[model samples]
Target: MSHHAKDLLTLAKAVIDTEIAALAALPSRLDDDFLHACETILACQGRVIVTGMGKSGHIGNKIAATLASTGTPAFFLHPGEASHGDLGMIVNGDVIIALSNSGTSEEILAILPVIRRLNVRIIAMTGNPQSSLAQAADFHINTGVDKEACPLGLAPTSSTTATLVMGDALAVALLEARGFTANDFARSHPGGRLGKRLLVHVRDIMHTGTEIPQVPPDASLQQAILEMTRKKLGMTAITTPNGTLLGIFTDGDLRRSFEKGQSLHEQPISALMTVSFRSINAHNLAVEALNLMQEYAITVLPVIQDGSVIGIIHMHDLLRAGIA
Candidate 1:
């Protein structure tokens, strides 16, 4: 590459290295204060109100969102806006988490008296523990970094990144403390792919009634093939007269029969079907069906209910629904 390109790459690497170093140094500083912050948020009966100014506000917004999504009820309040009648959002039981790298943001400091008057607890995250904001808080979390990634040290680079990481750490700690499960996460994110994977059941996507490819055990191989072709499932379920599943005849069975020089038109399907097959309950999640398919190397499974075949699920069904 050219000399100018090499110089640009060097500068980018320096910025990344500086941020990496800042993050690496953070764990040693996560002392009793970190635990106290987590406990305070966990014990909060009301919402967590996060506030900051400028770039700190941007990081605070993300922190609030992360906390909200991970079992803690939190929302961001612009410090400037909070002073202008928005301070009413705070209540006696609420917890305020204020972010300010310098620990003396005028907007944040402006609302301190009102917050104190309302009897709300404060958790200050700042680079300077001795700053007025930290000293005023019930708890202080030091997000101090040695230097900024910006060359002129005028931009909030390493400080913002460190603050964001600290927020994530806090959210995750609270999530684990609450015994939060994937099901809980799905409830909060019902519109996303995670919801589909965690909440969608076999019955939700499985084919039932007329859509199920089935043939009586006494039916001819030609009849089974016709049923499979008509249903377009690449296989046919062999059932007894009372609709109890007996076995399954699939395309693999047909290929083996052809190799054995068997008569496809005359033989009973029961004689060629595999009696031992994997099946899943209709109430199980769609992700379970995918796991069963991968574990047994099978593409389709019959959905069972009360010892009878209720529905059938295919790998394609899971894939089409974005569950796979």
Candidate 2:
């Protein structure tokens, strides 16, 4: 191998080894102090204000986002900006989460006095338990690692990963405590596929009234073909005289009939229609429809209400609505 490739491989191994050691060291560090931090943050009525510098700051931003999305109200405040006017963002009822690898970040320490005066609780995450930030905070979490993944031992690598994972641990713990559900997450992320999966009901996308293609079981195959064409769902439901669904005729049926040398206009649809079919309720989630579509390999599903076909939900409809 080339010298450059060998060097890259060594660096990668160093990073992995550093992170493994860091995670292994975490169990001993999990103590009563961590529980106290969780309790303090949970007691706060306002937001959890997160502040960190450099790589710690990047991790803190993600931590804040996870906290906010998982039911805890939180936002990131860059320590550098906090030294300026951003300190004003912290208010009463808020709790501050300060991140510093050495626990002596001047940018973080610069706002310590103001945060204290605001009567907000402080939870410090640091590698040094004896540093100024940890000493000044109400609760301190020890995220110290044996060494940095950086060969010079100056860059933040394992420390940052540990901090980020610790932040996720806090957020998820709070999420469970608050009874945050998938529906709640959907409300927070309405623009994403998860939101679509949770919020969409079968009734919203089902083809209703005359748009549903249905023909009596005794109807000629030509009549069923016309219904399928008019509905454009590539299928037609075969129903009883009282509109109760009996079976369905699809494009697959047409193909099989053509292969058998049978005239499409001659036979009754009931002779070719599938009598056994799986169906979904109108109130079921659209995600359930997606699962059914995948399992059956059928593009169109009949939505049933009170044993009667109320509407038709097509894969194309789900795809258009971003639910598929």
Each model's lDDT comes to: 0.92, 0.90
Candidate 1 Cα misplacement greater than 4 A, ranges: none
Which portions of model 2 miss their true places by more than 4 Å?
A: 240-242, 260-264
Sliding window of 10 residues with minimal summed lDDT for model 2: 262-271
**In lDDT terms, how accurate is model 2?**
0.90
Q: Across residues 212-285, which tens digit of lDDT does each residue of candidate 2 receive?
A: 99999889988988899998999999988788988888898889889998776767898889878878998999
**Residue-level error in angstroms, candidate 1, position 158:** 0.5
Taking all chains together, the TM-score of candidate 2 against the true structure is 0.94
Query: Using Cα atoms with residue i matched to residue i, what is each candidate's TM-score against the true structure?
Result: 0.95, 0.94
Task: Name the weakest run of 10 consecutive residues (lDDT summed) in model 1.
Answer: 262-271
Model 1, range 1-324, lDDT digits (tens) per residue? 999999999999999999999999888878898899889888999999999999999999999998998899999999898877898888888999999999999998999998999988899999999999999998888898999999999799999999999989989999999999889988888878999899999989999999999989889988999999999888999988788999998888899999999876777899999989999999999999999999999899999877678898999999998998
* TM-score quality measure for candidate 1: 0.95
Best by TM-score: 1
Give candidates' CA RMSD values in order.
1.6, 1.8
